[model samples]
Target: VNIDYLKKHADELKRVAASVLTGTVTASLLINKLQSYPRQNNLMYVLQSYGQLVKTIFICKYLLQLPLRHRINTQLNKGEQLHNLRVYLWFGGDGIIRKKQEKQQQVTARCLNLLTNIVMVWNTVYIQEILKQLQKEGYQVDEKDLEHISPAPFEHINRLGKYDFNDEIRLQENGLRALRPPVDKR
Candidate 1:
């Protein structure tokens, strides 16, 4: 973090930890060497930075796993989207509902839970009907693929602003198309 300190470790200071961490043994050896040198707070910016550098390197390494990272990102995004959907259904989520009062928190939390439960119940029926319809159209449907499908995007509910509460709904045609596995073209 200082002039001469950085001047000493200049090359390393410029190089990212991930590049160093690419070598498994190199990272460990460097870490051990940094540890064994001495224990001083400011003197060990190089040492302290190694932790972050190694983590960055580790993350960089995993970043190469395009499919794996994409899958994880998508699953995480799905969870976030479901939360957003719940917030849409309940108006107290001004994007910061977690910091709300205890009563509002309890009510919203309970309502979200209740909504999740209802969606779960409806999801089973929706998948079954989708499979039935797909088979009826001569496309072979697999039951296993529907195992993780949720009904979050089934937006045909009656929860618009300043309207009468009606629970009846109609299915959207394209809801489960992507979720269905490729047709057994054999």
Candidate 2:
């Protein structure tokens, strides 16, 4: 994240990391480490390379995860929002992602996540007003509680759409032909 420090030590760090690389390794997965005890014959090269390999492994693990630290935190925050989204999706006492096949279920879940996010963004103003009123009344709520996600509030949405996955859905103008739009949101 700090460009100045990266610029100054970039070459130095690269050199140090390179210098840590050990004995020549072949393509297949495992690396057989050869080391000798004090009583063993001359195998100094193998012994020294074993130690270097361990050190390199440790260094690479640490560096590999360093750049992902922020992304991991963001994932943690998004996880909390999933709880509320699940509650909304549980309209029929279960979410729409109850498929037996793991792959199919994953696809269903991702679609639901996107749909939920869209609904929350569309109702941003309504959600903000609620949060503002709570704050004015001296509630001790965190601003994060009013992030770009809201509970599923589609009172007019048809929860009884064809339950059978094999049935083709009727549509008109790219919208569900059998469903009714909410006459009023209030």
Candidate 3:
């Protein structure tokens, strides 16, 4: 199986998986009925690719929510100020202090949840690749041992996406669509 093909068509593979899961068609059934190719040969790679596709969808969804979350946080902070005023009037001192602590806990929990979700998505996408690369380098790594890594999948993808050639190509294509560079530049 060609890794380049897998990388180039990752998004399409993901769409296939999603269509299968959503009952448009059964991709697994199609794979199973194939007599020419053995499942073990490329199953892991395909699964990993599908996982990455899911992660990309999640990241896109998360980005859409970001502005709304910021707005909500801003409103919450403003509400806290009003709450503070009420507490000062009613309790005469330090009433807003408890609210502040609660707010801190709430914010910390939200941040942790966001981080965990991102990590879980990333791990699903690239854990197999990481293990494969490590084994290729003669490093012993256990599946269970990878749980301690920091920065969730989206974060890692964002970092790796910076250096990804396919992404660059896509961006360049888009740039050409919007603003055609000179033919000599190509």
Candidate 4:
């Protein structure tokens, strides 16, 4: 990272940033224009150096900060769990998106997202109810325990398009299924 070059072009950097923030210019358009330049653009070079400096600082902090690294790993694991759920749900077509057109592909992706969100909502609701039930039963339910729970679990979900509209399925007054009793650890 060329700190001196960035300092020299500080005003230019601010002007470009202002243009981006004010919507006078778009970042993609600026990148495209910069890339098209026959010779290396001075502002572009300065921006690249600035980006490298920011990246280096982040790498240093990520290496030194244990909490930050743990948080990042936790987030990454959760994301991977969600992706796994998506893959599990994509049972149709053998987990392959066969859509050829861009619009169709986008629609497929949106539909998958909607299904994932629906499953997440269902899991969240059930988890909250379970927590309440446990608390009511004189169990020590901690917030720390709740923090480790993810809404991405799909083990109980039947993804085979099975339909059972029987009234017995809705045993609770709230129209949700009755909460299952906690199993004994022993």
Best by lDDT: 4
The per-residue C-alpha lDDT of model 3 at residue 32 equals 64
What lDDT is reached at residue 41 by model 2?
A: 31
Q: Put down candidate 4 lDDT per residue, 1-186, tens digits, no spaces.
A: 878888999999999999999999999999999999999889888899999999999999999999899878888888998999999888888777898999999999899999999999999999888888888989999876665688999998987768788866656887788987667999
Higher-ranked by lDDT: 1 or 2 = 1
lDDT of 1 by residue, 1-186 (tens): 234655677576556455575654476676566678756544358656555666777688778888667667667767876786676667655645584589987886787789876875666666677677788889976765553455566465556557744555443674543344546879
Clashing pairs in 4: none
Query: How many residue pairs clash (N, CA or C atoms closer than 3 angstroms) in each of the candidate models, in the order given?
Result: 1, 0, 2, 0
Q: Say which prediction, candidate 1 or candidate 3, comes out ahead on lDDT.
A: 1
RMSD of 2: 13.3
Ranking by lDDT: 4, 1, 3, 2
Those runs of model 1 whose alpha carbons end farther than 4 Å from true positions after fitting are: 1-61, 92-104, 142-150, 161-186
lDDT (Cα, tens digit) per residue for candidate 3, span 95-121: 323335878868755654565565455
Clash count (model 1, backbone only): 1
Worst 10 residues of 4 by lDDT: 167-176
Question: Which candidate do you rate higher for TM-score, 1 or 4?
Answer: 4
Error of 3 at 177 (Å): 24
Give the clashing pairs for model 2.
Answer: none
Candidate with the larger TM-score of 1 and 3: 1
Give the best candidate by TM-score: 4
